[model samples]
Target: MRILARRISVRRTLLKTGSEQVLGIPKSGRSRAITISPQTASLLRKHQLRQKELRLSLGDAYRDRGFVFAKESGDPIQINNFGQRSFANLIESAGVKKIRFHDLRHTCATLLLAKGVNPKIVQERLGHSDISMTLNRYSHVTPTMQDQAARLLGDALQF
Candidate 1:
């Protein structure tokens, strides 16, 4: 996890579409550079430290591993193999409804927009090349945000 300016370069999915059928990611596009809040950065840092400790415990056998969690055969880490099912089961056990992993990204965008973050900033953070993409995805802004915008304009006009 590296921070470059307001962007955070992370090893994320880079899928290609259409008939060409490219399975793997390119060197430049595979690594995503996105933005994150300070709190998220702190949490990720802590998680990385914990992962490092776990790797150390595994000794030289774990040296130069490509994933934070993976099989001994060196396949890419997957949530199904990394306790996601267990996590969902726990949530269900706790009376929560089923939720897909992709929902987290939607939730984050909704929260950011609700908090009055500029759409452009949100688009950049989500790695959308255009602001319209972000706007189209999160078209419904919270009522509280609208009220806040009105109040801000009123205050600005007071001068």
Candidate 2:
């Protein structure tokens, strides 16, 4: 889903849910909007619904932790936490084969290239600071897109 606003607030009675801040800065920053597929959007909506349920279950004892996945004990989510470990374990159990967390990023680029998305658009969605950076990173996966450039030129010339 695209981050429509810089910050979004989620309000709940008797507790302060606070705002979810987008990661970006003004005047040519790296962070930008990324379009999520419809399936992913649905999953995210479901996840949000589950989080609401969790909050309700905890009642007044629920702490207003400003994290998407924070422990009831009020610990901030960290990279080395059980949440990340559990996710890694699930990926391993799925037999995805030797892939690092970083590789998921490359996989997204490859998929976008395979689906014939414009390189520039993909670059924007990925939030590469520059177009050249995106080109350098995914050049190997985007060779076929070169053919489209010739087609575009031909189409333009015919008009």
Candidate 3:
């Protein structure tokens, strides 16, 4: 789970079935590679170093399982427990409405689209099967983006 430049290997299987954490491929049934910002790479590197320190301090007491987000013993954290505790606390502390953890993916897509990143690029990052899916899912964000683009174009022409 090294978050190196251009990529971070989370190393967890990407599927959920009922309550069981069955390890397998993603919903698209294929692997995906996405790039990250240098800032993000730096943050992850820091996190990895901290994790290593914890591992070393714990010695044989550390489980050393490869899951990136894990319990004190290095076992995978249960999603339900994470939601009930960490996610809930985070929402309250941030003064934001409670949202499913999965909603972060939708939020990321919408924010990128609104910022004028190409839909195809967003599709690839989201591991969507096709561009249409990304476009359709985030269509609500497009009108505002279109308006922004028009404003920028008009401003340029006025110069």
Candidate 3: worst-modelled 10 consecutive residues by lDDT: 8-17
For candidate 2, list the clashing residue pairs, or say none.
none
lDDT of 2 by residue, 34-82 (tens): 5566676666667667766877888877675555555664344443444
lDDT of 3 by residue, 49-135 (tens): 888888999999999867666777777778877888899899989999899777788888889878778888999888889888888
lDDT for 7 in candidate 1 is: 54
Off by over 4 Å in 1: 3-7, 11-32, 68-75, 79-87, 93-97, 139-159
Q: Which candidate has the top score in TM-score?
A: 3
RMSD of 2: 7.9
Question: Candidate 3 — which pairs collide?
Answer: none
lDDT of each: 0.64, 0.59, 0.78
Worst ten in a row by lDDT for model 2: 7-16
Tens digit per residue, CA lDDT, model 1, 41-145: 777677668767767777776654455444543344455434477567776888977776666667778888887778787776666766786788754668887
Superposition TM-score, candidate 2 onto the true structure = 0.62
| RMSD after Cα superposition, model 1 | 5.2
